[model samples]
Each structure stands twice: as structure tokens, then as C-alpha cells.
Target: MTDPKISAFYVAVQEVNSLIQNGGTSSSRSLEEKIVEHLENAQLLGKLPKMGGAQEEVFMEVTKHGLRISAARSRLVKLRIPLIELVLLTTFVDGFGKTHAVFVEKSTTTRYQLHLLQLADDMAANVLCSLVKNAFVEAEEASALIEVIEPPSPSIA
Candidate 1:
């Protein structure tokens, strides 16, 4: 996040269908390709094509609480999502020749969103995805570092 060269981006956001996933053992590169294929299939099926309403210039950052999306100038929060609730994040180029970062949220409805972010450029998208995925992995590792044990209850006389 502290990279001096991080670029500012104008981003479009929209609620979308969840992405299709494969068996858990695939490599990272293959998983990304799978996301692209799934999205293309979705578009061909008349789903979530060119659907983002508007593009807002935003200063997005990865925070301890999760990813925080803010209005670029005013700094007001647009969306704040806890990473634990974020099921998946991937990037793909769309039929309209635009790139997007799509993710699924598991909070309640298992909803997903497509962000037509400028970060969708190949290098930027890859970097952002890696940052998020690595952070999520780190969070899971931290939580699993401890073991929980149940205490026995005393018998009443």
C-alpha cells in the first residue's frame, strides 16, 4: 500500500453474480484464467455485461479493518468491507474491452460486485489481487496460530 508509485484510479462499481470456482488445488495463474473464462461465459449468458453505473475517482486502500473505498477528494467512505467476509477477488477484461476487479462477499447473501477499476490494467490488477489474497492468507494464518481447548465442567454433589 505504501508503494510510492501506486496510481490513482477512477473506478466503477456494480453488484454482480458470484463467480464460478473450481477445485481448490489449482495454481494461482490458472485460477485467474478461470475467473476470466467464467466472466465471459456469464456475459454470453446475458449476465452482468456493461452494468456498472458510473466511474468515481477514488483513493482506495487496504486497511486493518479491510479494504476501504473513499471518495477521492472528500475522503468520505463509499464502502468498507472486512476481508473475512470477502470470499474471492479476481480481475478480468470484459467484452467491452474494459478491465474489472470482481469479488464476492459472504456476509449474508453471498453477493458479489464488479469494479471497473483503472487498476484493471494487467500489472495493476495483478498487484492488487496479490495484495488482497496475501493479506487474506496472512489473516487466516494468524488466527490459526492458536489452539482452542474446552475446559471440563465440575460435577455437582
Candidate 2:
């Protein structure tokens, strides 16, 4: 049986990719706004896990080595992991605007890999590939946009 968490992650990725692919031309909302709305809706619908509280933050960074996914629970502490530890099994983009990526943990030999879905236009796909490649170049670290935000305020009000 497929893991529910993985399924939800795939769904969220697919929706985000679709929005990026279409460039929000057909929707009244801008792409940035639509992304935030979609994320909230996904969490509400149980397609993505909800944050435990206002202090929790999750982010992904493409570094000179590999993708780093980090979860910060408190203001000063975070856990970061490398995405390359997962083996990419397969990837495909269909004519129907669907893209699928499968990955398995490096320690696992199972045929099944975590599945990720996305939508992308030709331009977006090219750009994504280029960016990923650049992320692996050691020199790119100087130019990469990292650590975008400061710690959130303890309270909004």
C-alpha cells in the first residue's frame, strides 16, 4: 500500500507545479497568491500536513551539493537533511501536463520509490533542470539565494 504522507506530498507538489506551468494566466489571482492559497487549502483538506504551530517552519534549499530540507521547530533550532540520500528511480512528464518523479531512500532496495507529481511547460522544465544542475556546482553557492527570512515574531498581535 502507498503511504498516505507520500501521496499527500505528491498531490501538493502536482498542484503547485500546475500553477507554475499555467503561469496563472487563466486565474484572477497571481501565481504567488495562488500558491499560498493552494498550500493552505491542501493542509485544510488533509492533502498536506498542517504546521504544529506558528513557530514551526519548513523550507527547502537547493545548495551547491544537493537539496536541503529543513524543519525548524523553535527560533534557534532546525534539522536539515540532504535530498540526495534518496535515490531517484524514475521521472517523466506527460503530454497532459503531468510530471512524475519517483525516489527511494538510499538504504532501500525496494522497487517502489516515493512518487512526486508536477506540471511544467517546456520553458519551466528547462529552467528547472538548469537550476538543479547549477545547484550542484560548487561555485554557485556565492550566487544562490539562501536563508531568505529572519525568525518570525513571537506573536503577530
Candidate 3:
């Protein structure tokens, strides 16, 4: 199944690329405006769904990593992605666009590289795999006959 978040991320990336191509001079204002417009239109800043238990912790960790943008400048620029949603968003639904995951090594005083990954298959399988791994193992084969039990009439009391 095609994930909607992935499509939205692609659209956002295309918008930014088009803006950059047409922005003439490489001005920070122009690029920033373009990002604001696209993010607002996509409505990704809205509320994210609740994920309980261990999944929530994983979601938090992924979010912390997802929006780790590094920029050297004089102006204040802030980008935010809800932590939990990003895991799912970037998984099957969201694309990296111009931005991507990276590892920074302070020793070099530079970004190592931008790494990209697709989430579709991994996200879907993780859920099922976790369930299977956690399920109890039974020692004997258990079979039960199908039976319909109707409630007795209330007046019987």
C-alpha cells in the first residue's frame, strides 16, 4: 500500500526544488519563505497520533534524530518535526527531500554525509514481527467448536 506521508514529503521536496531553481539569487529569505509555504500547505505541523508503550519511546528517539538540521549562519532558522510522527512519516509516508539523516564528526568540522532510506517495507514488517516474537508458545494443539451463546431473557431473573 502506498503511504500518504511519503507522497506529501515528495510534493514538499519538489516545491522547494522548484523555488530554488527560480529564486534567482541565493537569498536566505527566499529559501526560508519557500519552506514555510510548503510546510504550511502540507499541514504536517498539526497534531500527531498517540502511540503507547515501547513504540512511543522509539518514536521519540526517531523524532530527535529526524529534525537534526545543521546550518552555519547569522540568522535564526528553526525547523521542527513532531518526534513520534516523524518515525512513521519518514518510514513509509515521508521522503527526505533535500534534507536527510546524517552523522556529524566534530573532528572534521564538517558534515560526513547525508544518508537516505525508504521506510515502507521496514515499517510494516516491524509491527508484525514484534507481535509474533512476543506471542506465547503453546505446548498442545488447542481446538474449539464454534458455538453461538445467546443471552437468556431478562425476565428469567
Candidate 4:
């Protein structure tokens, strides 16, 4: 017997990978778009917890440096994406720029941790914000660029 939740999660991850491989932006109806669509059809979005408050509102946060996804707990579970992996991904996104998207996938059951990245040009960012607003239907904390600071070197004996 197959675990249905795991299967669905894998599908989402696969969709994300496909979208990134193709020339699709967060604004484009690419992998993230398709995965979200599937969630909607399955009625998974609302079934999950909202991000901030009672009045729902959803949007993607794209600072000049990074991309963040909110309102995606029930539809998809969060998994650890190590810092090294994120760096590699960001590099790829920079290379792709507006012409392509970058994504990562991992599966423990069927699919576990999956993420997508796109070099957000101003226009793409704006469009993505709008689409996320419509689909997410919930407000969330602003996404900030994660700066990994190393601990200061310990004094030698």
C-alpha cells in the first residue's frame, strides 16, 4: 500500500523541479503554478493553517536577494534545506536570471523537502506577488534574506 500524503508531496516536488528546469518565473504559470493549482483542485490550501491572521491574504516575498514561500504548511510540509544547498541554488538562480527558475527536491516517504528559486527581476517579482496574493489568501510575516554569520574564532590557548 502507498502512503497517499507522501505521494502527493512527491508530485508537488516533481512539479517544482519541472517548472524550474523550464524557463519559468515565479510569475509564470510554471511548476509552482501547477503545484498550487493541484492543491486548489484537491482543496488543500484552505485545509491547512493560514499564515498570519483571521482575514486571509497570501503573497510571495522577494527581496532584492531572495525568494520566500508562505501559506504552504498543510499543502506542503517544510523540510530542512541546508545552507550549502541554498548557496548552490542561489548561484544557479543568478545564472538563470529571468530566463529560468531553479528548484530542489528531496523525498523521504515520497517527497519531503522541495524548493524553487528564481532571480526576481522587478517585473517578475511584482507579478509573483499578485499571484501569491490571490492563491495564498493570507497575510504573512515579511520574508527576509537569511544571512548566515559564522561564530567568531575562539582565542587559542
Candidate 5:
């Protein structure tokens, strides 16, 4: 039997994809807002971290050598290394200054990991921030559809 939580999460993801495909208006609720609302309705948000707390910013300095992941403070152990059985949601800049968001899920007791989501734009950074704040509960359900939507590239100023 399929897990109800997983089913609900996929439904929410499809809804977000529909909104994006239809070219939702500025007055309409955004994909992030819709995702949060669906997750809330499904009672999955409680399993995740609460938003609006004091966040420890970990700056990923873009360099020619490639971006290295590091924690800004010792208290944030999750940022220090690639963790297992945990969700990683972070944003970084490429050498060209374009921002990208990545989501990874690591398996416990193994070196296996899944790169579930990646988006190249600032709006994705905002979405990634939301996902991180919520501890990425049910984020795996959205993984399949994430690649299908191509958000417009960030315009260089």
C-alpha cells in the first residue's frame, strides 16, 4: 500500500507544477505558498522545523576551484559535513555568479545519496530557504517533477 503522506505530498507537487505550467499570476498564490499550504493541510509541516527562527547563515563563497560546503559556526553541525539519513537544502553560486539551489538526501549506514532537486535561479533560493526551514519533510515527493519545470534564468545585472 502506498503511504498516504507520500501520496498527499505528490499531489501537492503536481498542483505546484500545474500552477507553474499555467503561468500563475502575481495575484495568485506562489508555488512555495501552495506547497506550504498543502503540507500544512496534510499535517506534514509539524514533522519539520518551524520557520522564522534565528537562522545561522552559511555563506558559500563562489570560486574557480568550485564551491566548498562549510559551516559558519560549530553549533550548526549539519552544515559541517554531508550527513546521513538527513535532507540537505542549500544554495550556492557558480563561477559566473548565477545562483543554484540543491537538495540532497543521504542514506543511513551507507555512502549512497540522492540528489533530488536542483534549480538555477534566485527564486529557487527562496524556495530552498523555505524547504530548509521546514527540515525538508516530504520534499522527496517533489523530486520527480522538479526537473520538468525550467524556471527562467536569473538575469545578470
Candidate 6:
């Protein structure tokens, strides 16, 4: 299932591009095309610790605060990748032509997580990415709306 407001991705693989720092490589091709190219060669990794299932059903929603990932059936949020924590967002296309929404998250100063989410189509991929990007911009604007000020000190005695 997919929606403009949210996207449901079958998490085909996590940590697929863990070794890469910037969330896959740069490409001059269209976003979807770049994904397809990487899909052929992206590293195959084992299941993440505590994350079972060949394909994990997760729902992703971009909010004012961050990007939310939740269990589809349970509706329990697994993780929220804050705007400040997101490294980069990229997408890929599987051989079947499904869209894979890839995002790198900075879990800690020393740890990063790469997620390969398989979306139903290209439109969902576009919507999700746009929302995430917009959220980041909005958050930055909100933070910069006001600046701290200090009153001048009284004249020295």
C-alpha cells in the first residue's frame, strides 16, 4: 500500500549500503535510473539485529519533526530519523521496476544505518523524498526565525 501523505515500503534489505558513507554514489542520471544501476550491485547484507522477516512491512511518514518508520500492522513507531540526523536520501529501481527508497541515518557519531525500502512505484518514491526534503527546510526556517539577544551592560561605575 502507498499514499501521497505516507508510503508503505517492503523493507527488502537494511544495511545494504552500510559501507558507503554518503548513501550510495552520485549519478548524473535520473533518480530512478541511478537506483536501478545500484540495485544491480549494492552490497547484500544480513538482517539487522532484532529485525527479522525476509521483507519487513513498514510505513514511512514525514512529519514536521522527522521521518517516522513504523510497523504496518502494529502501527508502533520503530524509529524516527530526525532532520538533523539524516545523512542523505536516495532511491533505486529493482529489476521488477519497483522503487527502492534509500536513506542514510546517523545513529551516532560513529554509527550510520542505510535502509533499502521497496516502494510500489515511482510516484510514492517522489512524494516521500519531497516530504523529507521539505521537512528539513521547514525545520531550519523555524529554528532561524528568532535569534538570542543580550542587553547591553550598564555603564561601568
Among these predictions, the greatest TM-score belongs to 6
Model 1 per-residue lDDT tens digits across residues 1-157: 3521223354445554433333255555554565667667766786643444445666667754577777777888777678877756777667776666765555556456555455536777777776777777777776677444445789899
- Candidate 2 regions exceeding 4 Å error are 1-9, 12-61, 68-83, 89-91, 101-104, 107-112, 139-157
Ten contiguous residues minimizing lDDT sum, candidate 1? 3-12
How far does residue 8 in candidate 6 sit from its true spot (Å)?
A: 2.3
Off by over 4 Å in 3: 1-15, 25-29, 44-157
Give one digit per residue, the lDDT tens place, for model 2 in 1-157: 1111111012322323344456547678764455445544665677753333232333334454454334433333132224455333334443334443323333333222232333233443344345455644544454354555466779867
lDDT of 5 by residue, 1-157 (tens): 1211100000111122333344366657754444434434443435322222243334432222222233445423222222223343445543335453443333333332322122345775675465344433334445657977899999999
In order of appearance, the predictions have TM-scores of 0.60, 0.33, 0.20, 0.23, 0.28, 0.69
Error of 1 at 143 (Å): 0.7
lDDT of 6 by residue, 67-153 (tens): 888988888987788888887788756554556777777777777666677776788888887888788887778777744445578
Estimate candidate 5's alpha-carbon lDDT, on a 0 to 1 scale. 0.36
lDDT of 6 at 150: 54
Candidates 2 and 4: which is better by TM-score?
2
What TM-score does candidate 4 reach? Answer: 0.23
Q: Candidate 4 on 1-157: residue-level lDDT in tens?
A: 1111111011123333443344355565654445444334433445422222242122234332233334434433234433223312211212113222223443332333333333235455345444434322322222222234455899999
Candidate lDDT (C-alpha), each = 0.60, 0.39, 0.28, 0.33, 0.36, 0.66
Show the colliding residue pairs in model 2.
none
The predicted structure with the larger TM-score, 1 or 6, is 6
* Clash-forming residue pairs, model 6: 35-92
Give a tens-digit lDDT track for model 3, residues 1-157: 2111221011112212344345576665644454445444444554312112121111111121232222223222223333222212222223323321111111222312111222234544354223222321111111112234455777855
Q: What's the residue-level lDDT of 90 in candidate 4?
A: 19
| Clashes (N, CA, C under 3 Å) per candidate | 0, 0, 3, 5, 0, 1
Q: Please say which candidate is ahead in lDDT: 5 or 6.
A: 6
